[model samples]
Target: MSSTVVETRRVFEVKNLDVYYGDTRALRDVTMDILEGQITALIGPSGCGKSTLLRCFNRTNDLIPGAEVKGELNYRGQKLYGKEVNPIVVRRRIGMVFQQPNPFPKSIFDNVAYGLRVNGIRDRLNERVETALKDVGLWDEVKDNLKKLGTSLSGGQKQRLCIARAIALQPDVILMDEPCSALDPISTKRIEDLMNNLKEKYTIVIVTHNMQQASRVADYTAFFNAEALDNGGRVGYLVEVDTTEKMFHDATDERTRDYISGRFG
Candidate 1:
């Protein structure tokens, strides 16, 4: 995996991105800029395709049979899905952490070392694992249990472990899909704080259903809604994307206001 590109600007500038799963459309012509060193949140109701857009950044959605993407998605000014682009290489630069804490059925140390091992990093595996665990605020608790199975940890600890795993890969950006939906309130708050701290070094994009969570940790928020079409599937659209404060306080779209104010999902 490549380290952060040394720059002083946005890492991603998505332009008129459209996604289709065979004959059904998943995302509309969505355009947004994800600034470096900031956390961007995607919030929408269930089945609204918030996760679909997130997957586009790393081209994960393409793995779905018949799924296709249209328009430009630039990363560091380079088109992400360009003909010469390799999805495996793209994923290396942009790592993803899913909703559940899915650590390998190995030792805690090995869990964090998996990425390093795959990338042929061997000189300082212990040090890197320690650094990532410390960053996720789990080092002190599990330092003595490095040899213990990762599955032995509690729910909160497991989630933090997964986060540590993501960071251990040292990707330029981290995409999180409902990272805290399964954890307790305390765990969720800790993860939120971790995200705030991680923004100093990582560009974070999170897909969350919790509006309050978006308001709390995101600097920018994109609100999405889906309209069920005559065909059987739904089509997702971006209603508004703005600074979190502005979107939450003074949204120009009536639909955005209604959704944010809890009038409708």
Candidate 2:
């Protein structure tokens, strides 16, 4: 009998990617592919470069002084870190949501409209804002309160608003850094559900310490760990990247198994 096969396209191809802050190497020899239209989770112990790696996706690392990257990084078969690449353009296509729900102090409608305005999207502003808000499941609650200050909302609502802000730009990839870290269980569940839905529309890369959350939302998972050096310093590197089911249940690397089993991080 003949078998049918399916192919998945890669959105980001990272080869021997290393990130350095001044003289210190924060990440080392990282190599992986971020597949298109799937949620890829970056899970690991603290200071293991999960967040650092996430920032590299959209070149947000450029914002940090002394931050430098080496090795090849490609997005959509194009060089992501090439001299001709514009960090602003990269960010416009690859949006980010920080660990904290950092909504502008502006009104709710203006908050979601912020990116649209900055990008010079003048036509159908209301439609775009409405679509993004509805996509993140935030419109119903804040529809009438569009003029209200975003900071006045509850923590969960604010985070959802931040998410709306990102999606309003219609980005191709969404990089979330511990998006639900500060929220309660109820809020976290809401965000997790939202993530599962969003993956159908945008490629997602999340840096999470919560193994359960990774298993719940991610289709693929990459585990990172800190390797000690002779000089009393450490560098974070990818241990394994695999289907979430395999990574959580049958990871090949002992370190991955250990981290998943709560043995060590």
Candidate 3:
């Protein structure tokens, strides 16, 4: 940890957050703060609500049928769940990358320019596309082939293109759900490095099962665990949230240690 004191901005404040799908609770009472310009990793077993909570930040949960979110979720001090909140606007401000690299079928240049065009940002469109691609370190490889289909790239490049799509909107935050889970080791490293660089400009929250990936890239980590239900099911809840150092070394919760130690999921 750095000894120097630094001021931090809170981008999202989640209080007693609970999520349900058709009256069944998936996550309960999740309260955590997402700080700006930092990568916060959400790690836990499957069905532990990491992805569920990640989607909540951008209101993607609203897309699912019968999905319900209760309790308080605030973005930049504004009530995120307020009646006046616009899910579309919320999504534009908080972009997301899904587990699989799901690039649009458009050409490389068009893919990066998609969001900008939607937002009526015709001015400097070329510059924005180039910058977003360069930000993800994809321009050098694909600059000459800008018309190539985004899906034609390798898995890693496709993922990078997807990232370029997200950042092109100049989003305040990026939510990645197991971004590197589908790539090879070399490709994973590239995404990890890209993530480390991205935190300087955009706040990031990622849900990943790879403990090493979380440890290597995240500045903060939130470990979630599930409790057994009477129906032989499990529901996830936040177990611990702390700096990466504290989470990996001296987590306050025994369940967190158990999960970290490989004693249980």
Candidate 4:
């Protein structure tokens, strides 16, 4: 039997990525490389397609009606949108955590086990769930209450449970879309800590509106902008891409400086 752990290289490399919703183009010629085992944060004002670009990594954009993608999105050297690429398979290898703490309504155990079961990872279910929960720093707290409803847990735990759910699949990269926007400061801090710990094992890409949060968790940062076209459509553009320090402290673009300095967004 093949080992469940698949050895993949460099997580993703995007080139000239353009996304369109019907006749409206949302993203234009965006390109970047995501190294394996690092956090790359996408930050910008609202409507910059920060979330849209994150969805592209795992081909989540394909689900939208009238949505189309142009250009190369390579995952470990394989073209993600290639004729043979299956989105379900892609999603299994690249998990996503959303803005809200969206834990399933089932028991915590079931919530974590759902992915494994669907993917035929059933033999060591309990052991794997334990390891995953521990990886997200939630094992001890919920060890005795594995059978409890996921909703019964606090907001922080629910988000962690979502993280556990994503990691249990052993994905190559995990995509987070503003995972902390809904949490308290304490909970947000915990999730940020979890992201740091998770970096050693999984490539992380987060889309956030909070510039401070981007600095805290992102190793590489991409600053984006949205252009209001005369046609009443918005086009997302990359204003700058650099290390978190350089982008925040040494930004070249006036817009980036303005946004970071609280002067304007």
Clashing pairs in 3: none
Clash pairs of candidate 2? none
The clash numbers for all candidates, in the given order, read 0, 0, 0, 0
Off by over 4 Å in 2: 1-6
Name the 10 consecutive residues with the lowest summed lDDT in model 1. 1-10
| Pick by lDDT: 2 or 4, better one | 2
lDDT of the candidates, in the order given:
0.90, 0.92, 0.93, 0.90
How would you encode candidate 1's per-residue C-alpha lDDT over 1-265 as one tens digit per residue?
0122234477888888889999888888888788888899998888888999999999999799999999889999898988899998888789899999899999999999998888788988889999999999999999999999999999889989998988897999999999999999999999999999999989999999899999999988989999998988888988888889988999889998998899998
TM-score to true structure, per model: 0.95, 0.97, 0.97, 0.95
Off by over 4 Å in 1: 1-8
Per-residue lDDT tens digits of candidate 4, residues 1-265?
A: 0121143246787889999999899999987777778788998888888998999989888999999999989999899999999999999999999999998889999999999999888798999999999999999999999999998999999999999999999998999999999999999999999999999999999999888999999987898999899998789988877778888899989999998888877
Q: Candidate 3's residue-wise lDDT over 1-265, tens digit each?
A: 2231137878899999999999789999998888889999999999999999999999999999999999999999999989999999999999999899998899999999999999888999999999999999999999999999999999999999999999999999999999999999999999999999999899999999999999999999999988889988789999889998899999999999998889998
Candidate 3: where are CA atoms >4 Å away? 1-6
Top-down lDDT ranking = 3, 2, 4, 1
- Whole-structure CA lDDT of model 1: 0.90
